[model samples]
Target: MSDAVLLLAHGTPNTLGEMAEYLDKVTGGRAVPAEVVEELQHRYALIGLRETAGAEPPPLTKWTLAQGQLLGRLFFDNGLKTKVYVAMRNWHPYIADVVAQMRQDGVTRFRAICLAPQNSRTSVGLYRKATLAAAEGMEVEFVAGWAEHPLLIEAFAEKLRTVWKVACDELGKRVPVLFTAHSVPTRTVTGDAPDPYPIEAKRTAALVAECMKAAGLGEQDWRFAFQSQGVSGGPWIGPTVEETLGVLREEGHRGVVIQPVGFLCDHVEILYDIDIAFRQIADEMGLKLWRAESLNDSPLLTRALAELALGPYTAGVEVAPISARV
Candidate 1:
């Protein structure tokens, strides 16, 4: 194929032993403190451990590849011949390696879509930089963000509806919803490099809530907050999931549903951050918490991605591969 569609994501290590190198790459070769590395090793171990010692395997890479394969099939079903590829930003199958493979395969021009739905300097910006910098002789285009796409909103709304029912049945009453997204350094967004990340995150949350409300759901109350605040510090986004849970507890909310609108699939963030860390905190606060499932291998999400890959991208001029069969 001379043209292809690429899916980019924040990759995870296939096993626990690679945490040091993964952290090194993520920090641009900085020497991550031993304590930090050890802490991360412990966190990764909690996700899943092999029968042997000192090994933890994650399913993010597997799920991401499945997403790509499904998207390729969806394109073929619609009479398109575009190929789909997945590249990791911080681990094996790195962007440069995949670009080299594509070049070797005689693929000329390709459109890249970050697996992240919302755009931010800390996330998609770095991804765009790495991808474009890797493709020296190839035509490259990107779907920077699709936070408010109807299909995407519908996909998330479906998760909410499914989880909301479980929350209601357990709590014996309707509960409030707390929409969330990954927190970035406040400086990057509100400081010098201001971005629409926060706005887009809120827009996604609002759209999902509106979709649910139109379906006669989430009428009790809904609030937006940030999750998985990093150790990079310098004041990340406001009203963290922990803080919000406290507020809900104080407000006498017996239960609350969490919907992470930013992420599209399961990774360390979803696997450990929400499923373990947030859940533990919620239990301590006498609050029941259920996160919306990751959109891994979801047919709706695959269709949404196919739409982006095949849709016309307006960038002062039409982006090539609009036909998706170049």
Candidate 2:
């Protein structure tokens, strides 16, 4: 495809009944237990029940589709005639199926990027596999792992500063900042090479903290944590956001700001994990809580992501050839 961009993100179930199938794919065909299934169903129910201004809960798939449209507009405005498509790993528009459709459209070569900024064998690595598997004869290039892009950092930093100001104005005190990302299994990220997921998450957090300092706040006011750990009976990464919350409370910080820099859009992890679950804990702890909004196809994020799609390799970057035919 001379002009195409594929945007990928973690897929969510369209309905509660689809949870088992989604989890099955996510867990590599493992049979989820009844209790685990029930818990997932509960979360999906809560996700579907969410509302804003009396409207219905927003579906992640719909939001992702809208993001693709926005990205297409950005690419067009930037003088690149790229057709953008959104595909999910476990949802309706599966990566492989989407690639098949793209081939029918006469597209030959294209660049792709996952919604996850940080590359990990567990996350972006999976996306790369699916993308390559689907491309029958197309030359596929992926712009993966854009964790430290200045514009991307600026986007989150701006949200952080905005939310921090809101909290301080309402509460009459500066709230500590806690940066969070989805916690992966320790086994997947540990070992000699070590996964860079946490490191990338912290890098974004540190940059946001630096921006906050420029806007007037001490370094000690900010820290990082992980969230949305799986319910699987395995050791996952820590210190989790829940643990960090207790620590902040013990340290006498009565209010806090959450910046989930790892996630680029508002999905179950953000809508429920932070907005509902974490808020419940904060209520019990008597702490005012604020979460920075996800970037979500905003102009800043679009510009940053668009630049990745149109790449010059950033010097010393070597992209491996995908599963393609000559």
Candidate 3:
């Protein structure tokens, strides 16, 4: 059987009009008001103006495609003949469509691994649903639970080390670290059969913190917070990074290293939520906020994905259980 790899992620709209459509799909047809749409557009405008290596901003799809290609190349280098695909959860080339295309391409055996390292039922679980639903009669194995992988921990720690140094140099003192992940509803993870998402995310942060200490970076001045909470929420997780920032300001901290452990690439969350919205708050509070760059097509990130793909993955588990053999 020919092997295929599907790099699954939550997608963003390519245009402002598409944003409303994207919101509709993700929110399960809930009505997103005009004010919310305007706010999202503002965030997108900020993201659009922020230049990357050129005078124009790069699309999230471009980065995600690059990541998928790089991951396929890594697997090939590691002696696996593979065809890689990029499947977005809420945009064009949706997971279902991608799977259909793969079937047409005669790929009967494949692995679908979410781009999110920390597996929450709402996030990774949704990816699993989309993959399995479209994978009709094919041998599909979903990979999960690589949040504590050594390579991933090392990758995050490297970025944290670099950004932490910047924060220290700017503030002239070792400041506190705040790790963040995209927040979902609190109950989705707190009910009877509680999800391992929060615990796994915290574990990744803890591993990075331990690695930082071992490298003589600084003491364990770190706390994990949730960020990029969606609108129309009765209550997402907390203490949010914003709330934490306020607390840090009140606590007399002058600088903070924002390490986003939950995200693998630079998207709306990292671009607008952290770079723009959070930065504005930090400026008002006289706090120095520096976020480590996301693992966007990083060699280390490719290594992590390649390892997860090659690792022993268990199938037939209802929760898309994955074991890290690293």
Best by TM-score: 1
Per-residue lDDT, model 1, residue 144, is 88
Estimate the overall C-alpha local distance difference test score of candidate 3: 0.80
lDDT of each: 0.83, 0.80, 0.80
Regions of candidate 2 where Cα sits further than 4 Å from its true position: 49-58, 315-326
Ordering by TM-score:
1, 2, 3
Error of 1 at 283 (Å): 0.9
Local accuracy of candidate 1 as per-residue lDDT tens digits, 1-326: 23899999898776667888989888888778888887788887788733244432367787888999998887787777889999999987999999999999888899999998888888899999999999988999888888887778889998889988888888887789899899888887775658989988999999899998865565458999998887754688788988989989999998888988988887777888888999999999988888888888888898787777875754222333324543
The predicted structure with the larger lDDT, 1 or 2, is 1
TM-score to true structure, per model: 0.92, 0.91, 0.90
Candidate 2 lDDT over residue span 300-323, tens digit each: 787776666666435124322211
* Candidate 1 accuracy as lDDT: 0.83
Which candidate leads the pack in lDDT? 1
Candidate 3 — which residues are off by over 4 angstroms? Answer: 49-58, 217-219, 314-326
Comparing 1 and 3 on TM-score, the stronger one: 1
- Write the residue-wise lDDT of candidate 3 on 1-326 in tens digits: 23888889888777766677878988879899989978887788777722123443246777888999998777666556778899999887799989999999999988888888888889888889888999979998888657877778888888888878878878887789999988888888886799888888888888898999965655558888999877777788877988999999898998888989998888888888998889989989999789998888788778777766664544212222123221
